[model samples]
Target: MNKVFKYTSIALLGVTLAGCSTVPLTGRKQLSLVSDSQIEQQAAASYKEFLGSSKTKVITGTSNAALVKKVGNNIAAAVNRYLSSQGLANQYNFNWEFNLIQSDEVNAWCMPGGKVAVYSGILPITLNETGLATVMGHEIAHAIAKHSAEQMSNQMLLQTGGQIVGAVTADQSMAVRSGVNLLYGVGGQIGMLKYSRSNESEADRLGLIFMAMAGYNPGEAVKFWERMSNGKASGTPEFLSTHPSDARRISDIQKLIPEAQKYYKK
Candidate 1:
């Protein structure tokens, strides 16, 4: 009886190990070490902490602010529809919120579980509603793609044994927190917050599709990217500095235009 139990446990472990897989849309194979529920709990907690630390300015009745929210919400809805059609709707189970920050840094990001912030500083670069949609779509796409979770999970796999990827008991979560600080580029943290070039390209392509599906003209992406490239050459935009170089990003986006155009609503 003891021998039978040992062999059965070994077989179960083998099956679980073999089942690690990749996500759709990005096609980057994942270690699948962490369960979705576990990650969601962690992400939700982290997101709340982030919000608490942030000094938020609620945008009220302003044209620019309203436009951004309108476009952002539209993109979010489109992303939900896309996920639902793919039979993956249950993955995002949080209340999504979008807000504009009255700041002078051309920056934006979506936290895990769909907390999005767009800075007023980026408005000039966006130029119009379509351009704003392009930026918001791209940022929101990162959340939809589960890039943050993948990034965190990859760090865990690297630190812990990949064979026991999903086995981070509560005792090990403290060590994982140290890695998170480094991953997020907190000053004095050991690791660099370097995003791979492939991830950047994927975001650009997927972002383009999301914007188009949300009723913005896909061709606007090309022009918007061109303006972005020019802005970088003239002087680096704060947002573009950490991103892939303008030439590389623009070329990649141009290549993705036809596919994005297919999803264009008008």
Candidate 2:
């Protein structure tokens, strides 16, 4: 390799080490090459646009809609309480919002900044409040763990050839914005990287703990995933497609329930 490129690679490796942040509860180090506040702002705009767009039908004033908000808030409160207890609350500046959207796509997601949406189609699979809590908690875990930003940072690092110290400080790129939109199935619908399997596992573990802290039985998550596994549909639900529900995932969640139970109380 040329001297310039070789030195640049070494510099990038140093930055990579210095730029790592730990995922709470999981203690896994992840890249932190981007700004959380910037990503949250972009996500907020995309979420607002998604809500305001003509094709979107946001359900309101119904029992199900209320339930969605309730579960989201409960999980958010649990997460916040846990973070605050750890003196890590200041690290997470989440302005939580939850809405039930009218779609038969069987999907739900939580964007960075605690913006959450639940598709009406998933309700049948969720069945009840605990089930909804399972879903919301899992999605919220993604935000809490900063999975989206981590993915974006890794992408930026790749695209900029490890010059992210400068790139991340610049205005958010269209690529980043597209990623935020894609998380919600909003714009372009391309090039967004899915969370890694380890990230998925972290979400499952933290989700169960969050749900348990919110007074839901973590064991319910197993049954919820079972229903998701058994459901018949015309095609793969967006939830399962992104989430990868399989025997191993279900078994891993089962193994995590005991850990989650420590936070549980009647």
Candidate 3:
């Protein structure tokens, strides 16, 4: 049994090392057990299902919808230009599409391969073209950074660790196994939350640069986030939340403006 545990630990360590990857621009190391093609395949299926479903009302043939596409395309083009310049263009093969959904959710999201959706509710908060670009750039950054794949990889690792724990504890009492599993589950959730916050921060940073490169003022990001913070309900603390505190995010964006401005063309 000791030999089995030793071998398993060594194997797991090797896999962890092999899976380590650096996030673009941020240079943050992340686990990437899944391939980009796999993520894109899943995203394509999910995006189709979402758009086809009755739960979502996609708005089209309107000025607002056009604006969403315009801003999304600008950011996407800028990101592609950067990737090409870095000789990483082959890393992504995006079939970009942007849609506006009629909802009051005050949110937007982008999937792998540049599938994007913006909620009408968020437009009021965005308030202008620059603000809209701020939101789109951030969401697009999440995809460009491959955050979804990183998250999936983290979950895979956590599950594998749990299975290893269970195997090693096979001789223990059922109560002991259950207790250990419970503790592991709690720890996994906390770890996931931390990763999510980190992803959001990275997205914010990358988005600022992308918007600037796309000819949008990076300074608008601070204003957009401030509006979001005002609308947020008083709930979980920053440590427990899956996003940075409003003040912290605003301050960070302010500091990043100069760096992003370097990429600005106008």
lDDT of 3 by residue, 160-246 (tens): 877887887788888877887787779888999999999999999999999999999897788888888886665788889999888
- TM-score versus the correct structure, for each prediction: 0.73, 0.81, 0.93
User: Could you tell me which 10 consecutive residues in candidate 1 have the lowest summed lDDT?
Assistant: 184-193
Q: What value does the lDDT take at residue 154 in candidate 2?
A: 65
The 10 consecutive residues of candidate 2 with the worst lDDT sum are 184-193
Query: What are the lDDT scores of the predictions, listed in order?
Result: 0.70, 0.83, 0.89
Model 1 residue 22 lDDT? 58
Once fitted onto the true fold, the runs of candidate 2 whose alpha carbons sit more than 4 angstroms away are: 1-11, 161-195, 231-245
Top-lDDT structure, candidate number: 3
User: What digit string (tens of lDDT, one per residue) describes model 1 on residues 1-266?
Assistant: 23333544465456547646556576666445566667667766876675566565556689987887798889989888888998888876746777777888888888767788888888888899999888888888777766766666556544433223233322446667455334333431222134434556677888999998889987788787787667645365423344667887887888888998888887
- Cα displacement (angstroms), candidate 3, residue 149, comes to 0.5
Give me the candidate number with maximum TM-score: 3
Which prediction has more favorable lDDT, 1 or 3?
A: 3
Q: Roughly what TM-score does model 1 have, to 2 decimal places? A: 0.73
lDDT of 2 at 135: 92
Candidate 2 is scored at a TM of 0.81
